[model samples]
Target chain A: MAFRVVHYINQFFANVGGEEMAHIAPELREGKVGPGMAFETAWKGEAVIVNTIVCGDSYFAEHEKDAKEQVVAWVKEINPDMFIAGPAFNAGRYGYACANIALEVKTQLGIPVLTGMYEENPGADLKDKILITPTANSAAGMRKAAPTMAKLALKLMKGEVLGASCEEGYMPNGIRVNFFEKERGAKRAVKMLINKINGKAFTTEFPMPNFDRVEPGKAIPDMSKVVLGLATSGGIVSKGNPDHIEASSASHYGEYDIEGWDALTAEGWETAHGGYDPVYANENPNRVMPIDVLRQMEKEGKIGKLHRYFYSTVGNGTAVASSRKFAEEYAQKMLKAGVQACIMTST
Target chain B: MVKEIERVGIPVVHMCTITPISLTVGANRIIPTIAIPYPLGNPALTPEDEYALRYKLVDAAIKAFSVDIDKQTVFEF
Candidate 1:
């Protein structure tokens, strides 16, 4: 008997009217709707989409809680072996609905779920919570997305352990999965180095996340009136590390009071960062954060007052995503506190 | 992280030993520091000289806040 799979998609992919039909609510059809045919072909009798759940993008966006409840109820009734949602491409609302519905089914029904979308789709933000295969920016990529999704779906149905994101075609979700490679680490690195020197195209095993450049903020008009903020990834912290920030891959940041501090003494402060030699920084924590010098400038009226609080986190091996989250959270606080300028240090 | 702070409209200068990584990460204003272990201070110097060196670097970083830059820039010390 073929394994049962339940598929979800928005109205446009269900052969329902496009923008005009976007207000339609949730409905479940018997089997094998538009894109389901592609999954069927790829499944090759190993699994069959027993049911298809269709919801309009606008309806889901407007009535998200209700739409999700309805879809989850229907999926529970079907109780398929696995669930799949749209390769929603670049349609924002549809991608969001597909990713959310897939997440709901997986959590509520305890079933495996998969979805696909363009890498930049807002839905891709949920990639850490669900499996999302990257697709092209438009529906034209369906031919490729289908087979890739289907192969992974089949693996999930068979209860097989999955490989790394690069091996399995899913976005890197922060969860590191270990797997064996044919070549040893050193041998593979040497080959990659050779490829690089010869100008041959080579894929990096650890690719840096795409960084968005931000326009520089307007310059402060007068340094004497600016409230300077201090932050660091060099991991300077209170001597006891009261917040207990990890030495590497720090998951959180520490905010400390420096209202009257003139210097970071060896007994009062230390570096929690494991990436570098800690001796110098431990002897004078200001080497990493430079709070002492900033305080001197403040006293001399060279600059306005230093913000009383300093933020610290270890940058050693920290994920870019984690670092971004930390900064976003604190930047809002700094703004509210009237910080006009900031100095950030990293080791 | 420096970029994130800048994204929120706060002028920020990154002081670090590795200027290339700071540039790669899209910091707008950067100040190259002395070394990874002692970015602002040199233990080889007397405490007074070390404090002066750190004061100079921090001063440069403060200067970065007021400089108008259209692209990623390193504020040389």
Candidate 2:
């Protein structure tokens, strides 16, 4: 059976006119339109675009819900084996409409959908949600886009497993795949080094990640009126360390309820922090987190209420990634509890 | 991790015996501890004196949060 496909293009490419014609509602034509003519040439007889659904960029953006439902209803009637959205380059509205409609088409119809857009396109953010072949920055690159989109759509129609992003020329979908290279690590490194020393460019197997530099948040105007929460990397826990967070390289953090409690004692809690000497912190755990003093402050009306629960994790030898994960999770929990400020203690 | 908490907007006064390392790690506010093992108190001091020292540390840290300023700050006891 010839693989049947449905193609989606914006008003401009569908010859519904340019920006002035962008108000056109989505309507299906019998067969290939505009870029689909190029796709037909590329696909040969392997696949045919049985229908072309065209929607105006502005109309689709302003009336997304109605536009999407209308388009999905039409596509459901056509029932193509695969769907293809725009090679929408850098056109923001058009790219957004293409990716948006393509995602719904795949979801409601459960067919493989492919799109193409410039790397910087806002629609590129949807690369993980649907297949998006990398395209040029404008419609001028439609020649390159058509063949790339057709090849991938053809693969999808035939149920062929797609290759890596670099190999297949698509945006990386963030799914990790294991593939052994012909050359061993040592050989590859030597070859890479030779190429680099010869002034030739070499692609690195692993790219360094850029870290976020967060600006400090505005300070609280009045501590007495705000809820205060306590978080610690000192590893002070309730008595036996219920969560069993390791003394070093802790795997998890524990949220202990401290409401109506004034002191942290050696009997009730101890230090799980391995980096520091345990005797003093264990004997008077409050010395580390200063919860006892905070209670005193609350009583003295120096601050509002202390948050009911305190989070504890051991920072000693703990991975940076693990600590970040702990903070991300517990931070949201504290925020939900109305904690406007936090006291983070470390050993 | 102090930097991480501060990054999220809640100001942190890192109470550590090692002040230089705290500043180096980009901790915005810092209060020096009496010792590494027991940051709040000096065990050699009498109970009353120790309480005074701990109170001084916590008071300084909390007070630091009250003041408004730009850039990193260090709170001394």
Candidate 3:
């Protein structure tokens, strides 16, 4: 039996009025509507689209909750084996509606779902959560999108394993599936490094996450009046590392009282970091934490008194997620204590 | 971690040996250091010399903290 499929598209693609018909409520028709013709040709009788859900972009966006429930209830009756939403291209509102409905059908109904959108579409927000094939920024890419989406949709319905995003022409969905590579990791890394040195392009095995860029806080008007707190990811701690923080990949942070301290002496402290040789830091702990000079600044009135407690953690090999957790906890305590500014040191 | 602290609206200056890594990790105000193992003081030098270098670096860090910056600004020592 041919797998039954349900297609979703905006009113514009349904031959309804363009912007003029944008306020129309969702309506469904039996089989092969608009772009469904292209999908039918691509499927080659392996699967047939049994229904197409047509809705206006404007109506869907403004009344999403009701529209979603209404559309979902209707699709539930048809109960397609797979669902396909628009190759919405760069149409923001259309892309958004298609992505949302597609996601809903897959999640709530457990139906195999497929969608396509331009990389910059607002609907791209759902990329990591769905199988979103990449389309061109405009509908001009429709020819390429329909065939690709159809092929993938058929495999999806048959429960066939799919290849990586690059090979299948889809956006990365943040789910990493293991695949064999031609070269060993070390050799690949060496090759990448050599390419980098030669100013040639090489794909990295692990791409760094794009962290949020935080704007710097307003500068202190009078440094002499504000209390200063010290924080370090260099793993400086009291003698014997009372907290036993791991020298590398530290799981926790330590807060210690620096009250009445003139400097971090050899007897009182040592570095708990393992990323580097600990010889010099153990000999004189101030090199990493700079407690000695900070004290001098307090005495010399170069700045206000230092806060009594300082926070420390090991940054080496520490996961960014854990680091965020530790900072969130301590930063609250530091703020409540009226610490106006912070100085962080990392090895 | 420094990013978390600054997100709370408290001004922060990060002093580190690896300036590029610090920037990549999203630090706003940065101060360059001499080495990783000895961020503030170099053991190869005399104690007095080490203290002087440490003082210079810390002073720069303090200045960086006090100065307003619209973006990532590295305070050189």
- The fraction of reference interface contacts (C-alpha pairs within 8 A across chains A and B) present in each candidate is 0.86, 0.46, 0.86
Q: CAPRI verdict on model 2?
A: acceptable
Ranking of predictions according to DockQ: 1, 3, 2
Chain B alone, TM-score of each model?
0.96, 0.88, 0.94
Candidate 2 lDDT over A82-164, as tens digits, reads 98998899999989998999999989989999999999999889999998998889889988888888888888888988777
- On a 0 to 1 TM-score scale, where does candidate 2 land against the true structure? 0.62
- TM per candidate: 0.81, 0.62, 0.74
* DockQ of all predictions against the true structure, Cα-based: 0.82, 0.38, 0.75
- Report the C-alpha lDDT of model 3 over A1-347, residue by residue, as the tens digit: 99999888889999998999998899989998899999889989999999998999999999998888988998899988998889899999999998999898888999889999999999989998888999999888989998999899988999999988876767898877678888898999999999999999999867897788888889876788778989999899999999999988899999989998899999999889989989999999999988899999998888898999999999889999999999999999989999989999888
- Clashing residue pairs, backbone N/CA/C < 3 A, model 3: none
Please identify which of the two predictions, 1 or 3, would achieve the higher DockQ against the true structure.
1
lDDT of each: 0.92, 0.83, 0.90
TM-score of chain B of 1: 0.96
TM-score of chain B of 2: 0.88
Model 1 chain A lDDT-worst window of ten: A202-211
- Tens-digit per-residue lDDT, B1-77, candidate 1: 98889888899999998999999989999999999899999999999999999999998988888898899999875
Best by lDDT: 1
Please give the lDDT score for candidate 2.
0.83
Model 2 chain A worst lDDT window (10 residues): A208-217
